[model samples]
Target: MGKFFYARVSSKDQNLARQIEAFKKMGAADEQIVCDKESGKNFNRENYKALKSALGLRAGDVLIVKELDRFGRNKQEILKELEYWKKREIRVMVIDIPTTMIDIPKGQEWIMEMINNILIEVLSSIAEQERDKIRQRQREGIDCMPVKNGKKVSTKTGRPVGRPEIKKPNNWSENYEKWVKGEITAKKAMENCKLKRSSFYKLVNEE
Candidate 1:
């Protein structure tokens, strides 16, 4: 039986040093540990998939993670993965969940299983809820951003925050005046301004 460790962080900018150190402290060799700097929302991470490959884990082998959420943040998906490991007889030991780290006597294994299930259920739910709260906060922050003309603007600089607004062509005023007097078609005005249909319409609608 082999022991394998997995570590994860939400983004490439985040550090995996702490989790790696924890694994090393537990006597896990570098080669036995795989780390992924990817979101915990899904199991589609590269290093994570490599760790779960057939050649990596096997029956009676142990898979260790620093925390339950390090395994994943989606509660249902996390539970599904745990069921997969259980069916394959691969032990998953989460360091933060102490009950998962204990070895149970053969006959009373159910007791440990029950306790571990309850703990995992609660922790995974919390993890997923935390992810949701983070996303909600991000949306709120974006929503609170000041809008300028027709775009979101930075409160500090009063400049657009997202895609830059398309500039009006130099001849826009002349052509727009002609179009307003019914002397030129809107399409003809757009052609004269050298702007695309959507760009011309967008500029026209902007105050």
Candidate 2:
């Protein structure tokens, strides 16, 4: 019965203020604006749900959003919400670059409406698939890169040049002599020796 506009931003770093400003330029009142600041992978949203509950939205009530992806990334969820609006004869306006056109279908115009819905579904599917491909490519790129700031040691290559020397621990005699002579405690001796409790005990048993 009234104009309902919804906007969304994917993260806290993003702002919905621009979207609200645009909607205001279109003559929507402040109270008519609804928003969400979260990922659009799904439609389970507090603000989005409130917008849906205000339904039975007549033929002229319009739904506005910043962009399609702002509405949702999941193809199925996007298609589902759009279809809901279409069925109720509610118009949708997307405020992208040139702003969006709102075309409400009636009578034989339903054919064009059906075609447009089909196009929206096809395009949403392709976008989601392309995003998946790009993410996979980036992950593969990271895994293939060499470990940085570390050595790739080998007998043929020797120690990697300029890398710091890594010390190996001494045997039980040195550790026990240091401890028994009160030069160090058992704990400190074990740590400096870099041996486990069981290994330290084995060394003590040997002497």
lDDT of each: 0.90, 0.71
Model 1, residue pairs in steric clash: none
Q: Write the per-residue lDDT of candidate 2 for residues 100-149, one digit (tens) a residue.
A: 35443466566766666666677678757765776699677555555544
Candidate with best lDDT: 1
Instruction: Give stretches of model 1 more than 4 Å off.
Output: 153-207
**Alpha carbon lDDT of residue 116, candidate 1?**
93
